[model samples]
Target: MRKSEYRISELLDRLARLNQSELWTNDLNPAQVAALKYLMAANRFSRAPSHVADYLGATRGTVSQSLKTLAKKGLIEQIRSAEDKRSVRYDVTKTGHSVVAIRTNLDEALAQLDQNESANIALLLSNVLHSTLAARGGRSFGICKSCKHHDKSANRPYCRLLIVELAEEETSLICHEHDSAA
Candidate 1:
């Protein structure tokens, strides 16, 4: 690998180590916390174990295990989907929200950056991630607001892909079907 690539990899490794060290105070493992974080940010439509697996690029079995653990901890609840009773949805409970709300070392570090610096860093990382995912033929888990399928013509925005009028709260969420807006 090139020097820049090696540096990037090292940086990511250090970040992961920092996360592990910082999050050790919490009872849950890194995977569980990641799931909780994903659930907290995901839209109502993307709250299933399958969605989590897809987003994390983890196996279905692993995602199922993680969901089971979260449910056992009362951090998340399983409910029959309102639209489809056969399908089950996962939702973070009040406790789960509180758990995920606790700031980690990475969060604290990012908070130290100025608004402009943060935005720039985010943009740079996003570009890197987008390109890397595309190269690997991986799904780009993009935010709904920047998706091509987000129809803003109506007074209330809707997702053309999902064929449902989106709630105001859902507009900023990460969507499984998200496609980048040109």
Candidate 2:
């Protein structure tokens, strides 16, 4: 690998380890915290266990365990689908949002960056993530508004792929079926 690429990979690894270590606060482990955060940022259609697994790149069994722990801690609630009893949706609780509201060191560090620098870094990282996921045959799980299926020209935001109108708030949340407009 090129030296720059190697350094970037090393830096990402270090950042991930640091982030994981810091996630042990609020009586939650890293996995549970991650699951809760995903639930908080996910739209209604993408809040299921399967979607969580796909987003986290984790096995269904592992995601299930983390979800169970979150539920046990009263941080999240499971809502069974009325149309399909076998299907379940997860929602972050008020307590969960409160926990997520607590700022982390990473958030503070990012806040230190200038707006332009932060935006540039986000864009570059997003490109890297897209390439990596493509190479690995993984799902993008990107924001609904940035997806090719988003139809904002209509009176209401709509997802052409899902064939349903989306709420304004839902357009900003991540989706399991996201296909990047780029």
Candidate 3:
């Protein structure tokens, strides 16, 4: 690989590690905190344990144990899916939401960057991530509204690929089946 490519890769990997370097003083482990944070930001369609495992690239047993611990700590609650009685969904409690709000040093450092620089960095990082995921045959977790499969022409915006109607709030959330509009 070229020098620039190597530098970019190194920078990204270091940034990711640094971002996750600090652990909160709370009772929850790093994995549990991560799961809660993901639940806090994830769309309704992506609230299942399976989806969490997929997003975190963790095994089912690991995710299941994390979910149980979170539920026991009152950080998250498991609810029966309205559509399917057998299906279960996870929701982050208010405490869970607050747990993830404990800002890290990484956030403070990123905040030092100007708006233009932040935007440019975000765009560049997103491009690199997309390219890498595509090359590795990994799933894209982009917002549904920004995906090529999103159909807004109908009365309700829906995913052409999943054949499911989307709620208004779901448009901005990350989708497991998301494909880049570009």
Candidate 4:
């Protein structure tokens, strides 16, 4: 039997189906959910439109529209940057924070729910994501590079998880599909 690779879309679909838990009780659409995810994953969602632009791989206009929609829904609040009032920063509101936290924790719990069969694989993937974030120089306080899980070895720079075999020249790049920790 040949091992198969999973597309991100497939994983997302699985997650979506299993996401029956009302972690985020708010009645948000897909775009809203994505906005919230971006905020939660970003720097406490305390940046301006430009910051969102980089994180979401979106343009300022798109982020602006989403921000506007979130703000109108009272799920988030926009505060003008004190240093640069012209710049607006978006943060979760009281309700927003609650739901965001719920979703975040529920996601963890769901992952933990599979503690029997393939839990190891689930756990390994989590580690890979953490290390990838670190390899990019993200910080725990900011991006992924600042994480404690990040590892930099002569064999795998900025990566602690031996997800895959490293190449001779770019020994740092690991096979994302392989879940072995070297």
The numbered model that scores best in TM-score is 2
Q: Which candidate model has the greater TM-score, 1 or 4?
A: 1
Tell me model 1's lDDT, rounded to 2 decimals: 0.88
lDDT per residue for candidate 2 within 100-121, as digits (tens), equals 8877788899999999999999
Question: Candidate 2, residue 133: CA error in Å?
Answer: 0.5
Writing each residue's lDDT as its tens digit, candidate 3 over 20-74 gives 7675448877788888888887877788898898888788899999999999999
By the TM-score metric, which is better: model 2 or model 3?
A: 2
TM-score per candidate: 0.93, 0.95, 0.84, 0.51
List the RMSD of every prediction in angstroms: 1.5, 1.2, 2.4, 11.2
Superposition TM-score, candidate 2 onto the true structure? 0.95
How many steric overlaps are in each model, in order? 0, 0, 0, 12
Ranking of all candidate structures by their lDDT, best first? 2, 1, 3, 4
Model 4 ranges off by over 4 Å: 1-3, 6-9, 16-25, 44-46, 101-111, 114-182
lDDT of 4 by residue, 1-182 (tens): 22333566477567666674443357665556667656655542235666665555567788788788888988888888676778777777877666666545446756666566467766676676567656874332333333333445444534344343333333322222223332
Decide which is better by lDDT, 1 or 4: 1
Badly placed stretches (over 4 Å) of model 3 are 1-4, 154-156, 160-165
lDDT of each: 0.88, 0.93, 0.85, 0.56
Best candidate according to lDDT: 2
TM-score of candidate 1 to 2 decimals? 0.93
Which sequence of candidate numbers ranks them by TM-score, best first?
2, 1, 3, 4
